[model samples]
Target: MSYDPRRPGEDKSQRAQTRERDDAQVEKAHRPDALILHEIIRREGEEEMRRTALALSLSGFSAGLTMGFSLIVPGVLKGHLPHEPWADLIVSMGYSIGFLIVVLGRQQLFTENTVTPILPLLTERTSGAFLRVVRLWSIVLVANIVATIVIASVLAHTDAFKPEVREAFAEISRHTIEDPFWTTVIKAVFAGWLIALMVWILPATGSAAPFIIILMTWLVSMCGLAHIVAGSVDAYYLVATGEIDLAKYVTGFFVPTLLGNVVGGVTLVSVLNFGQVAPDMEGQDRVGV
Candidate 1:
């Protein structure tokens, strides 16, 4: 039954229905907005920035070591599978394993810093803040590369893996480094964008974080996108085994991919994300004017 606006009170059933609808609307409205997510990730970035250099270095190394599994698993899959179209699809799933390990373990992966450290810089806009971000990026990127070198050397010299697996690894490495310099750089930009996007989404995803990490990384692999950290493992493995010279690895693979990733993450993802949220943040700062 409808009630007149002038009535002192509505019918009991109608009033209860209205209250329930109002409560539901309020609950929906209070759910986290984009600005809220931005703040959550920014706070996390601040916390990470506060950690010591040694701590960051160790964690970055561990992340690099862990990322090795992305290559190893795909190698194993390719080793076991017949030379068929479907094999590539199955092998790409292995690319996500290392990412899952690093992300869930909370280790410092360099690509992640492309988004995280930049958040603080965006907020502070100071020379010191910029330098701190540079320091973190330098430490993490170098540590990741060092770990890749160590692991690639071990894999190259030791008989730890099966012969078939080693062959598969070589095949994967060759395929990765064979891309033209400019092509690799272009692909790496996409890889960087996807990885940075993954970091931005994680805090909001909660329990689904693992699936998000896997899906994004899997796309990176399937699409043949270059990623600086994971690609380092593939590129350096070839170097360790004398398949590619140091100059080729540095000029052909490393430098271009590094520049591409930085451009993609910093320019494409972080800057755009901040731009989207900055206006609302500024308005929030002013009150009772």
Candidate 2:
């Protein structure tokens, strides 16, 4: 069916409708560009910085407590699944459960702070903004760690779970402290990078947010990435059970993972993304956008 040039009126009408539909489709598919994403995250940072210490602590503690489900779910799966190696793939899906809860629930997570607060700090470039970021990070991290300690101890010392599940927790948690210092740090860097990237992506995900969170977190789990908060659950579990002492947990897992997470989340995600959008943002500033 070829176009009939003689029927100009019909052709014009069809062409106009086609153009309208195409324009609508383009608008629908337009994800927020980098500059828009930067502004969104920067505003999120500002909001976070405004939170009172008590608010941040309570939220962070909830996040940390919720993160323990990453351990519980997988331990449950590992207990129920057949002993085949492929079973780990199934178990890994459970690892995303805690992340799904935390992300969707808007809990204050520490790794998320590594990127979110950094955005405003980069934009503001003031001592006060920097101090707020430091304050937020400090309070959130400590609160998260404290919550992890509480949960891990409960998982360790309580008879809350069945023997198999407890044993599964032990089996799973031992790996966190098994790695050498540098190795754990390297793993943590990847974990932090992925988690931060997930944070950056969330603003753009819209209805797919849960899927993205689960996918990224599951990858971290499947690859055995050493996330500071999630791994803290594991590390502290080991500590609680007397499998590893406090000194060992501190020197081996805590210090290195924390350092790596900061480096990975701040340097790899926040700094790089801010650098990418800074010029455009400055242009927006000049133009009063």
Candidate 3:
């Protein structure tokens, strides 16, 4: 007679063991893959698109207010350290502090929205969806800028920080505005690309999410890339201190950085990633955790 594994009266202990092993294997097979991660983040983006305007505005304002630490921490560091070539590297690491808090806190940062909202529009491809993306962008960007302006004014007018730290802030702002227009644009592109890539990789990072955010943002700072939200604080601080005129700040830094960031996040990161997975995403109905 041929041996049959499922024969009647099979050893009970052996059957139980076999079942347990099969269950473990099944669970392992269900772990998320790269495509699944893409779907997961895409779903998240769609949900964010559906949030109320007020909700987005509040979160964005909070993010902008909180991101001041990116400058503050670095300014403090630069204040304490003696001026040297390598001091910038150490100061750049301080730049990561604000990003960690903002991202981990789940606030609506405008840079992050660049990639997140684009995903929903890509999948839906409707005029309404396109408009919604624009609405979210406009609200978040304005809210963030307003918050930055408020914070910069307070820092400039009041003794919010020590003299050394305040001077450091002015020095940082001076360097930021001193960059040529095209240089700011190009650097902002790199910043935007990196920030969007951070969003894309976040779903797959699991517990290491904070480290990734810090690393990418630190790279942005170290490379002297312009970032709209963070750079807004720098620009506004210059205006507050009378170091640079409002018109120059807006026309020279804000406009180019904003355009460059949008191009980098939407065109380079969002569009390219969507194209890579669009062919495979057709049949999936819902993707989530």
Candidate 4:
């Protein structure tokens, strides 16, 4: 060991093998990167969706109840603010809280799931799986929206809200009534896009994703973006309180917002995500490889 200078060349191949083994050991010890996490989350999402279909009604009702925060938050915040535009921002932040919970908690949210299940269908799965996903999305979405409307109406009629909250609801209702149908639809499209983006990002971020979701969704609400399920609560509140006509709320707010959300999620986020991931997909022809 002390006279190694002249023998340095003797162990060259042995040293190289030792170094290679060391490198392999190091690589094995390293934590998983984004790609691995992505796969884990993708599979998790798929499994969640499968379970969600069976529990669709309960999930839809919970989504409705949770979505009511959208109406209540703005209404509550309006009481604190002096009838100014900035008050809307405060309320919108509150609205996003419910979404953050339902989504990050891995509870079934109708809109977000629309894009997820479709990805699997793009491959060679049976047509039945594709139809099942669609059926699940449609049922959950419809039930959620209906639940929101019903709850909102009850809250409005019962005067469960404080006087200040009632005033805020009325103020918020006026804006919905005043806006043109087309504008509501457009805003809803953008809102849905943001929500879908949140869904996409969540899989990549793991447990910490709720913060990102809260931020983006708050921005969506602050910017006056519309969301179908959440917005229905506000629309129905107007009808329940006798402040706005039911027909107008249905034709104007409900129809337009729902259409906009679908367009945003499916046409924007879902399609874009598919296009980005399509090239990377390999071994598709093989069965479950």
> Pick by TM-score: which candidate is best?
2
lDDT of each: 0.89, 0.92, 0.87, 0.73
Clashes of each: 0, 0, 0, 0
What candidate 4 gets wrong by more than 4 Å, as runs, is 1-45, 52-54, 84-86, 283-289
- Lowest summed lDDT over 10 consecutive residues: which window, candidate 4? 1-10
- Model 3's C-alpha root-mean-square deviation from the true structure amounts to 4.4
| 88-175 per-residue lDDT for model 3 (tens digits) | 8999999889889999999989899888889888888999999988888899999999998988888788886889999999988776
TM-score for candidate 1 = 0.90
Per-residue lDDT tens digits of candidate 2, residues 172-199? 9988888999999999999999999999
Clashing pairs in 2: none
The alpha-carbon lDDT assigned to residue 271 of candidate 3 equals 92
On the 0 to 100 scale, the lDDT of residue 97 in model 1 is 97
Candidate 1 lDDT by residue in tens digits, 1-289: 8843333577888777877887799876675777887898888888888889999999999999988998899999999999999999999999999999999999999999999889889989999999889888888999999998888888888888899999999998886788888998899899999999998888778778999999999999999998988988999999999988999999888998998898889888899999999988888888632
Q: Model 1 clash tally?
A: 0
Query: Over all chains combined, what TM-score does candidate 3 have?
Result: 0.89
The full ranking of all candidates by TM-score, starting with the best, is 2, 1, 3, 4
State how far residue 79 of model 3 sits from its true place (Å).
Answer: 0.4
Error of 2 at 136 (Å): 0.3
